[model samples]
Target: MGLSMFALSRRSDARFAPARSSAELPPSFLGSGIRVRGVLEIEGELTIQGFVAGRIAALKLIIAPGGRVEGDIVAREVVVSGNLNGRIFAPNVTVEETAHIDGRIFHNTITVARGAHFDGRMPWRPVNFFETLDQLPETQP
Candidate 1:
């Protein structure tokens, strides 16, 4: 409803690219058995139930229960119901009660449910901060 994802994609080819419509390719799901190391770029939704160590850029990212991710994440929307040990740069974020997080969160809007185990900082930022993110900052600010 704000700036178009398509327009933003054009500026971030390293992590954002055109993908088939979500209707054509269903949301990607990483199972619990999988462990990945690299960049995960998606135009649609991505549900992670595995272990990942790298960067992730997506329209929507959901860290499912039992999942664990370590690194940076840039997305329009992020919902954490698992474990995360990195930074998140997103406009909207939801941290479920089952989430176990340890890192920084930079969001325009955020909701953290009761019982969530988080050990880090949550920094509020303007929405424009997400639109212009080209690389992960060398240090958490």
Candidate 2:
């Protein structure tokens, strides 16, 4: 009876376990001085401490302080604390105090710290269909 109960508990735990998706993946890093000059497409989160000269696409991206990326970035979320010189497209973007970005940003939400510097346009948009619909002109039925 005890063995059966233990098995049932294990099965219940398995059923309630968290799903493993790209968004849940841990952050990965690129060491300094290593330069990537082509497109980077990642299924999970990534952190760059080196230099990249091409486009980056990921579920989440973080540019650590002292890192440099000179290409476009498209991700679900992005946190920048380094130097970026290309366009950024993310649902949420946070630029830390030490960040420097020189490209346009297309984000649903953006946060910039006091010491952060951004020299490009930030085009705000809604992340959900409902929010987008709310912004449209009302039409008669």
Best by lDDT: 1
In the range 43-130, model 1's lDDT, one tens digit per residue, is: 8889999999998988889999999999998887789999999999887799999999999999878899999999999999875677
Clash list (residue pairs), candidate 2: none
What is candidate 2's local distance difference test score? Answer: 0.75
Q: Cα deviation of 98 in candidate 2 (Å)?
A: 0.3
* Candidate 2 regions with alpha-carbon error over 4 angstroms: 1-26, 128-141
How would you encode candidate 2's per-residue C-alpha lDDT over 87-136 as one tens digit per residue? 78776788999999998888777789998999989988656421233233
* Candidate 2: residue 121 lDDT (0-100): 96
Cand. 2 TM to true fold: 0.73
